[model samples]
Target chain A: AQSVTQLDSHVSVSEGTPVLLRCNYSSSYSPSLFWYVQHPNKGLQLLLKYTSAATLVKGINGFEAEFKKSETSFHLTKPSAHMSDAAEYFCVVSAFGGNRDDKIIFGKGTRLHILP
Target chain B: GAGVSQSPRYKVAKRGQDVALRCDPISGHVSLFWYQQALGQGPEFLTYFQNEAQLDKSGLPSDRFFAERPEGSVSTLKIQRTQQEDSAVYLCASSSPREWGQPQHFGDGTRLSIL
Candidate 1:
């Protein structure tokens, strides 16, 4: 079984302030973790993915996430939040092995709101 | 040609009516997937196809849902007799040819409303 949890349902940040969206995962095998952002009525855009690569993975738009295995966490962070960063974010987990039944699991999501 | 595309951006169907959602994956991408996303909820996997092969459909809620990728390019997800509970955003995604750790490219999705 594989699952992910977004610790916060909604997060509010002021533009130019730091932002943090926490996520945790549960999996039986080594997993691939990802962060994705979706604007209103838009498809999911990949932010970053951790596939046993560098623990701290940087993504586009000044966003990054650190994969902490000991804590079973993959938390997305932005040094400075922008108005455009206000959107819903999802944490996802995929299996590392090629199991015929492997399925990716998504977190409930955290909606970010930015204030100028 | 640039990204995955889905048809019927929005559909409103009466209860018990059938609906079909179309998805066109990136050309030559072998892995395609369908998902259901309820309001404020994360998208849930419904099915996956590798080429024309329907490799996984266990996540589908019931037999009311059926999916086909006839020629390994375009796919359709048909809902037989939709219920109010069937209202959700149907998302389609495609990744490269691989079994694991492939980042999927997603479509804008088709919003279905069962009234």
Candidate 2:
């Protein structure tokens, strides 16, 4: 079984300040983790993905997330928040089923609000 | 044009009515996925297809939901006898191949409002 948990439903950060959105996961197999952002009325855009290669994954728009196996966490972060960064972020985990079918699980989501 | 495309950006249908939504995935992509997203929520997987083969439909909510990708290039999701709870944004995504750590490209999605 695979599951993702986004710790915060909403996070408000002041412009020019740092931002953080926490996420945790549980997977019986080696998981493929991802962070995706969705602006209003827009499609989901992949921020980054964590394969086994590197623990620190950098994404578009100056965002990045570090995969911590010991903590079972993949928290997204940014050095400074921008007004355009306001959006909903989802944490996802993908694993193979017993039949080898890909099964992806998504978190409830964390809404980021940038305060100017 | 290079990314996935979904039809009927917004659709309004009466309860008990049937509706169909379409998805056109990226060219040469071997994997396609359908998901249902509710208000202020992350997407929930509905089904997956590897080319024209419907390998998984376990996430489908009910029998009223059906999906097909006959030719492997395009896909359609049909809902029979829709209900109020069925109102959601149906999202479609595609990936290059069935590989570990493959990121999916998504379409804008179809907002279906059941009246």
Candidate 3:
């Protein structure tokens, strides 16, 4: 019953401009949220994770996402976009159904296009 | 070598042919997962294994899709009677058992193409 929705299917931004990718989730339990990036023909790389520790979580490569409980949103952001930032971004949610059921649900994904 | 590894980076077969994909998890990872990713779509869960126990296989699309983690380390996903709909990138990921909220490490994936 847990699901994640990415607001945009594609986002275009100029180099040196700020970037934003919006995501929302519906979960019955306190969720563990994550952001992952995948390049063409490459595996998905974890960006950041929120495990009930901090609302604001920082990730690799100058990326960050904030977990808003009231709004049920975990949107990813970057201070400035770079040419290398072009990739597919996914928002994930895990219900934490004990140790046996750690399956994570993924959003449809938003493709980021950085223009030079 | 340090991350999850999947074999046969690309596979092409006839519609009726059977294909097998392999995955080798990290040295000590206790949880392994298989996912199917169609073009322009997010990965969908297929099955999961905790050590050698196949705990969940509910996400499997049909009986033709089967997966197993035999020795708690190596896993294989076999698709019998492959069809055009089964052509997708099959991804394998592993995570540690120590924490329920741990992030998963992924493989580059095996791209299966059914002709």
True contacts kept of 1: 0.88
Best by DockQ: 1
Q: Which parts of model 1 have CA positions greater than 4 angstroms off? A: A98-102
Predicted candidate 2 versus true structure: per-residue lDDT over A1-116, tens digit per residue: 88999999999999999999999999988889999999999899999999888999999999999999999999999999999999999999987546744768889999999999
* DockQ result, candidate 1: 0.86
Q: Per-candidate DockQ versus the true complex?
A: 0.86, 0.84, 0.85
| TM-scores of all candidate predictions against the true structure | 0.97, 0.98, 0.98
Per-residue C-alpha lDDT of model 3 across residues A21-51, encoded as one tens digit per residue? 9999998778999999999999999999999
TM-score, B chain alone, candidates in order: 0.97, 0.97, 0.97
For candidate 1, lDDT tens digit of each residue in B12-115?
99999999999999998999999999999999999999999999999899999999999999999999989999999999999988845779999999999999
Clashing pairs in 2: none
Per-candidate local distance difference test: 0.94, 0.94, 0.94
lDDT of 1: 0.94
lDDT per residue for candidate 3 within B62-107, as digits (tens), equals: 9999998878999999999999999999999999874857999999
Off by over 4 Å in 2: none
Question: Can you write out model 1's per-residue Cα lDDT over A14-79, one digit (the tens) per residue?
Answer: 999999999999988899999999999999999999989799999999999999999999999999
Interface residue Cα RMSD of candidate 2 after superposition: 0.9
